[model samples]
Target: DQQVKQNSPSLSVQEGRISILNCDYTNSMFDYFLWYKKYPAEGPTFLISISSIKDKNEDGRFTVFLNKSAKHLSLHIVPSQPGDSAVYFCAASGYTNAGKSTFGDGTTLTVKP
Candidate 1:
């Protein structure tokens, strides 16, 4: 089963604090992991990605860490801003596939003023 799981349906935090989201997977075949951020009625944009061979990847205020042994991953955003509020999806892909991804339902984050 190629299932990705984001247990939390939503999260709320104050601006300038750290925002964290967690994900898990059931598919052992996944070799590449990606994070995508989306807003209402818009397509998801690539945020960060990590290969199965690597443990972590970072981009600016966003960081993603993967633990292959646990089949787990997380995304962290520091000094979270109201603009950062959106839905985050955890995804997995493989070099074997033509860059298609399997995504979790998504976690909605809200940053308060």
Candidate 2:
């Protein structure tokens, strides 16, 4: 079973608007969650992250929220710009995994001008 899933394969938003990306996990052991942004022909870059102990984390225009009880998490980007358009991947890791992470298939986000 896929432990991490991004049910929506894609999302679209206009520039200067809010973009929300959702993720779900089936593994209760996951204690850390992360979001990565990937551009074409380049590696994924870390965006924002949240620890299971915390419900929310924010960095600049990006924020990540974790709902431990629901085994769900979301990434929010406000005032999204065209440069923010990319494929976003959600990943989860447990202490026992030795730093290995389970990644979602990814959701392509398009920011329109």
Candidate 3:
């Protein structure tokens, strides 16, 4: 049914702390995974991505880990900052979809001062 799920609707953390977001998928064929960050009234910006062939990908303060056996993935933001307050969406693409991504409902992250 091509459903990507983000169990938590929102998350909050204090500045300089680590923020973790989780996602799950029912479709087993999704091979390309990506994370996007969105600010209010703006389109989502690509943050990081991981191919199913790999288990983890990291960029600066952001990291994404995939567990193929479990059909689960998670995003980690280190030292979360006030500027990081926004919505995060997990997306997936695969051979069946010709690289078109399907998105999760999204998780809103708030960083407290």
Candidate 4:
């Protein structure tokens, strides 16, 4: 079964606006939630992450929020730029998984200027 899922396959936002991407997981074993951004041919780059113990984590213009009770997580990008347009993948990992992560299909974010 697919443990992690990104309900919305695509999202469009205006430049300088906020882009919010969402993910959900059915596995309770996941203790760490991570967000990754990928361009066409490049490997996915780590964006932001949060632990199940915390509700939120922020770095620069990117922020990640986790709601363990709902098995939900979200990534928010403020003042989204054209460069921010890419496929964002949500991944989850736990100690039991040996650092291997379960990734969602990914959400394509398009930031229009």
- The number of the candidate with the highest TM-score is 2
Q: In terms of lDDT, which candidate is stronger, 1 or 2? A: 2
Worst 10 residues of 2 by lDDT: 94-103
User: How well does each candidate superpose onto the true structure, as a TM-score?
Assistant: 0.94, 0.96, 0.94, 0.96
What's every prediction's RMSD, in angstroms?
1.3, 1.2, 1.5, 1.2
Pairs with backbone N, CA or C atoms under 3 Å apart (clashes), candidate 3 = none
- Per-residue lDDT over 13-87 for candidate 3, one digit per residue giving the tens place of the 0 to 100 score: 999999999999988878989999999999899999999889999899999999999999999999899999999
Q: Over the stretch 1-113, how does candidate 1's per-residue lDDT look in tens digits?
A: 54899999999999999999999998888989989999999999989988899888888999999999999999999989999999999999885772688999999999998
Provide the clashing-pair count of each candidate structure: 0, 0, 0, 0
Sort the candidates on lDDT, descending order: 2, 4, 3, 1
User: What's model 3's lDDT at 4?
Assistant: 95
Candidates in order have lDDT scores of: 0.92, 0.94, 0.93, 0.94
User: Which candidate comes out best when scored by lDDT?
Assistant: 2
Ranking 2 against 3 by lDDT, winner: 2
48-86: candidate 2 lDDT, tens digit per residue: 888899999999999999999999999999989999999
